[model samples]
Target chain A: MPTRARRWHISWLLLAAATIPLLAVVSLFVGVSEVSLAALLSGQDGGRAAEVLMISRLPRTLALILAGSGMAVCGTIMQMLARNRFVEPSTAGTVESASLGILAVMLLAPGLPMFGKMLVAALFALAGTSLFLAILRRIPLRSVLLVPLVGIMLGGVISAITTFFAYRTDMLQSISAWTTGDFSGVLRGRYELLWIAAGLTLLAYFAAARFTVAGMGEAFATNVGLNYRRIVALGLLIVSMVTAAVVVTVGMVPFIGLIVPNVVSLALGDNLSKSLPWVAILGAGFVLVCDIAGRLILYPYEVPIGTVIGIVGSAFFLFLILRPNARVA
Target chain B: MIELKSVSKQYGDTLVVDGVDLTLPKGGVTSIIGPNGAGKSTLLSMMSRLLPMSTGWIGIDGLDVTKTRGDVLARRLSILRQDNHMTARLTVRDLVAFGRYPYTKDRPTGEDKVHVDRALGFLDLQPLADRFLDELSGGQRQRAFVAMVLCQDTDYALFDEPLNNLDMRHAAGMMRLLRRAADHFNKTIVLVLHDINFASCYSDHIVAMKAGKVAFQGAPDAVMQASVLTEIFNTDMAIHEIAGRKIAVFY
Candidate 1:
């Protein structure tokens, strides 16, 4: 029986690993410009196909992989730290806080480099996530449903503040552009910051066991000689930094964090060390598919990946919440 | 030896474990019997460094629990509370393997795997090793947790009501296992038990607590008398000798 289970695990992992690059290749061809593999291979069109592939398609595909995997890993870490299955950066005010930070930089230091903007946004995300956790601690009745509800409320308030300021400064259009996740603007130079998110995701994988132990609760972690508070702090730092990088580079991609981790956990169980790779792979693949579908749905005109994910993710979220037998934490 | 000097835990204005000064010798089973609010669990928590003391000291073999590093203390001592709720869905083997974290962090050595398997076999949990925790019965889960603590290989182990959800057969089996751990492995075992008969049958020493203080402490034979048991529990009780053991009978 155990051997069978192990075999099943490996086969699924292999399938997921093979699916990601296939999706990436498919995503590369789905853009408005006709950059076919044959053309690129033949070097036909005086390097125009190569140029588009390098300047746009490759970067967008890489960005999708990095951001998707990063956001999904961030969701898993957030869920562990919060001890709630439903909490994610998008719902927990982390993305809104990043938006607020971007707005602040735009108003206060308009000439700051992208790296500087990402750092400030990361700090703001850390603070905002900590604030959400603080609020969670204060409320004694921490039902599974109540946690995400609180986060959504906090995100609503922060976004409201950002909107009011943007309206006054006439930066509302730019703010909207930055707040809605669209990969069409992802050029070679614009999307490299997501590599930091990808790096943080790798760091998360190394610390996966500690995060799993921490998710068992404070007493349990202490019993095993783990520094519970330190692990939680580290987890939040990773989550916030990743959120900041993604939001700053590609705007807010809602529910990839929520939907991907939940689906992964449902399939693979919540053992972080065993399940994290699957989470990353599935997350990248899910986003890649969404991006491809978005590009092809309108054929030359595109729906943002954010809109595609939001519509699909919210339905899955509703199913999770409304399911009678959800083994919620 | 585990030594406690004036250990107290206070929450706001209420004192839970008040000025507890005691010493538990090594290499035997000691049962702490008390009512719900008598602070037995709180004192145990303070001793194990799970709950910080308001004003006091706890030393396991002369190493102060507060001053020593957590991993260092963890190697010497381990504690398990009654309500062990976990967000992560771990198999029994995975959970047991975590007992070696203090030594290996996350990468389990071959020796650690041996210890895990030994602990699983000790607890009769080998068959259930691959099952997720939520899939097990309460008694089976309780045994899995005990296996983890045993796999930790600490010198001193404390359990806060280890028999909470066990059926009679498993409860007795658990006591026997703890007794064997004490006798065979030379571990210092401390437990908070509501069942006085089990304490009398299995424990070498019994400490009875009342109103956040130790009312009495001695051998089980000395502490299991009708008058002492009656006063500690605030109930009418009688002691009967069954198979050369003192059994408290209260209706």
Candidate 2:
């Protein structure tokens, strides 16, 4: 390794840290309701400014941070376990499975609480991930590019099933809206499930080295005395739960997981322990900036964070596909 | 001693390794040589517990490999496979340091660092230790991986085709290093080698296999006969004595 790349740099981290609050502050001020600290302090705008900031702006900002960081971290774990960089919750049918779970709960119980629905979604997500992995292991992959294509196809199959079910149940509008991933509907008490995702992201950091070892492949990891199967199961569980929480709360952001980790790896290399904090920070920052852009693009109105992220993230994904010597596992 | 009792590997109906029973004594170099599809690598993998056996038991130092705890077995034995492709961009030193993982589990002690450095030095990888594995040539990467298994510092170290992709000078140098590893440290080294000449030169005992069965095994002097070499490989070989070592010329 180059001497510069060997040690983790404090300056880069400081810059990432500096960017989050800057973006968060910017996001806080650009909402549809023109609310400000000055207005709140003066007890003006009939006190509506404080409620809007507290209920809408603050919660939306926090949701963006949680969902962004959560999805990025989930992506990292999924990629490691799947042993393919392009595999993420959305691509691998995890998001679609969670949506299917939500749809099932809506039709079956019709009385399940939000937490109950999230639990069902998580279980379904886990199963979906396992199915994708089983399919992945069956085929001999000649190119790194084929792995994600398989995942996208798997996701497409599950998505078609979910869409068909939604249409039959007359819940297509509701399900379609949920899958689009907008922070516009985020308000007090609605985004709390995302806190579970935040907690899971911390657990991922604690197990970062194990996940890194698992990425080397089952045989190599077992030789090192790690239980390859157990670690993989843990990783999949983490990815599924995080996906379920984020999907349920803020909906699906297409490629935060894919783009953030690749960018971090290119800059810092792929040592998960060293690169994890950066992944988290950059994930949060990327979403915050994108969310800010969405809020401002039509000013006084808003573009869904998912729509903006989808547009920008796909562009970045295209660049990754077209880049020279694109070595992805 | 590593003991295998009726160990076999079956993929569906094909028996890759069938009823292999052998006890490899402790210390010195033992080479398993055979033609293609001879199950040499498969048997090595089974012994190292990298591949599960279908119908038998393997005991390393009296501890059943299938029953022993992973970390405990790790401390007792280690293995290096032919293909070490990985997605993580690890430096040679970082890769070697993983040998200490069984002991340190990600937290490297001063002693672990010492072992890592010593292994790196042993393989002449000190200069390339800081380089990323992908940046190095095949021979260099092979040496780096050897350094890692050496760093594991286990009593029993297994390598599958350790000399693949190496040129002549590096191949001989690698065999010499492995020979020293066995002789100087009294470590039990098991290797699967395709090059019979290298095995003949360095191995104290050679086991030849064909069609998933051990065809012949003995001290190099006994097993390297022209008739035995010709029978196992199905090619006529002329054995010549050079510097008191048997060299087979089959090409």
Give every candidate's TM-score on chain A. Answer: 0.97, 0.96
In the order shown, the candidates' DockQ scores are: 0.67, 0.67
User: What's the true lDDT of residue A4 in model 1?
Assistant: 86
* Tens digits of lDDT, candidate 1, B65-90: 88888889889999999788766778
Residues B78-184 of candidate 2 have per-residue lDDT tens digits of: 99998877777677888888888889886768898889989998888999887877788988998988898899999999999999889998899889988998899
RMSD of 2: 1.8
Q: Identify the CAPRI category of the predicted complex in candidate 2.
A: medium
In terms of lDDT, the poorest run of 10 residues in model 2 chain A is A1-10
Model 2 accuracy (lDDT, Cα): 0.88
lDDT of 2 at A144: 86
lDDT, each prediction:
0.91, 0.88
- Give the runs in model 1 whose Cα sits over 4 Å from its true position: A1-11, A327-329
